[model samples]
Target: MKKEELIPQYLQDELREINDIRPPYSFEEITKLKDLLDHTLKQEKQLEEAEAYGAIPKEEADITNLVLTVKHFVLQESIKDAIKQLENDIEEKKRELEELKRGN
Candidate 1:
């Protein structure tokens, strides 16, 4: 999907509805989320570089490996939540589309 379509501003506004504690996130939260995403991205890049150039050193790379594993676990957990949200959104959209098709 196009970047514009993927992150529509209206959806961003809608996401704020999920935040009831301490109001919606501020720019700081956006930065933090960006940093976390970037860190995961960098880890993926390192894994690719290791594969392409040479294998990670078995002893020294252990920590990085563990970190990557833990990051992946957290990502999977987030993905599950995202999937649930997406499923609900899809159902709602489907219902709306059907209503429109029926001229309701």
Candidate 2:
């Protein structure tokens, strides 16, 4: 199935925007986001089951809030990952500069 098919229609536009950002998401990052969405859906199912079983109050089983929270988390994590990769690249460049200076 297409990666787009894995994402819900409501989230497609947002995820596309994220994927289009500078530095963009790597293929691995996109896969991770898909996995996160899958996990969130599973969790939502569990919540519904719990509510049906009277293990949790119906009012507390808020799937919309859960989905939104997960979406926010995914965005934050993707940004953090991008920042970390950029930092690593900067550090590597600094090390290469030091080596060049020593050679000169």
Candidate 3:
């Protein structure tokens, strides 16, 4: 097996792990992961532009890094959004409870 084939497999495995764990983590953790993802995305774009203009060595390494970074981003966003949604739902429930308590 070549390095290229190995990278995709590793990337997929990493993403799967992230997906599996994201549901239980806190919002702050997820936010931090999102920041990391944003940084990786910037680096990935830089690498792509560099490749477009010239022949670059070690391109595979950059691509693998990008894939992992993207996986992180996907998990981070998923968890963060889920937390936000749950928070909103809780807030709505609280309001309803308060209104019922007041009988208004």
Candidate 4:
């Protein structure tokens, strides 16, 4: 099966948006994104099955909302990681400046 097929149709637009962003994703990131979507689809199927069996309330088996939440979560995590890296880089530059001053 095509790697893109692993992601549900509903989530394809989000993936495209990610691809359109600057600094295109690496192969590893693409693989991880596919894996994450595949896992999410599996979980969605399980939720649907549970709802069918009456184990979960029908209203609670909102797959659309679940997918959106996952997308939001992934975006949040990526932004947080980028912010952390920037902060670390700023600190490193500060340390370099201090060292240069001391050496003069």
The lDDT per prediction is 0.55, 0.64, 0.67, 0.62
- For all candidates, the clash counts are 0, 0, 0, 0
Top candidate, metric lDDT: 3
- Quote model 2's TM-score: 0.46
User: What TM-score does candidate 1 get on C-alpha atoms?
Assistant: 0.40
* Candidate 4 per-residue C-alpha lDDT over 1-104 given as tens digits, one digit per residue, 9 for 90 to 100: 78556556857776566444332444465555556556656766776678778886544456454665676566556545555666777899999999999999
TM-score of each: 0.40, 0.46, 0.50, 0.48
Q: Which digits, one per residue and each the tens of the lDDT, describe model 2 over residues 1-47?
A: 77555445665665565555545556576566656566656656776
Candidate number with greatest TM-score:
3
In model 1, the runs with Cα more than 4 Å from the true position are 1-59, 99-103
Candidate 3's C-alpha runs over 4 A off are 2-5, 8-21, 55-73, 76-80, 96-104
lDDT of 3 by residue, 9-104 (tens): 746665665566555456665665566567656656776676777655565657766685677567567756767877987999999999999996
Give the C-alpha lDDT of model 1: 0.55
Model 1 scores worst on lDDT over the 10 consecutive residues at: 14-23
How big is the positional error of residue 75 in model 2, measured in Å on the Cα after superposition? 1.0
Candidate 4, residue 12: lDDT = 78
Candidate 1 local lDDT, 1-104, one digit each (tens)? 56444443543342342232121335454444446556666766887688566686654355455555666555445445555656777899999999999995
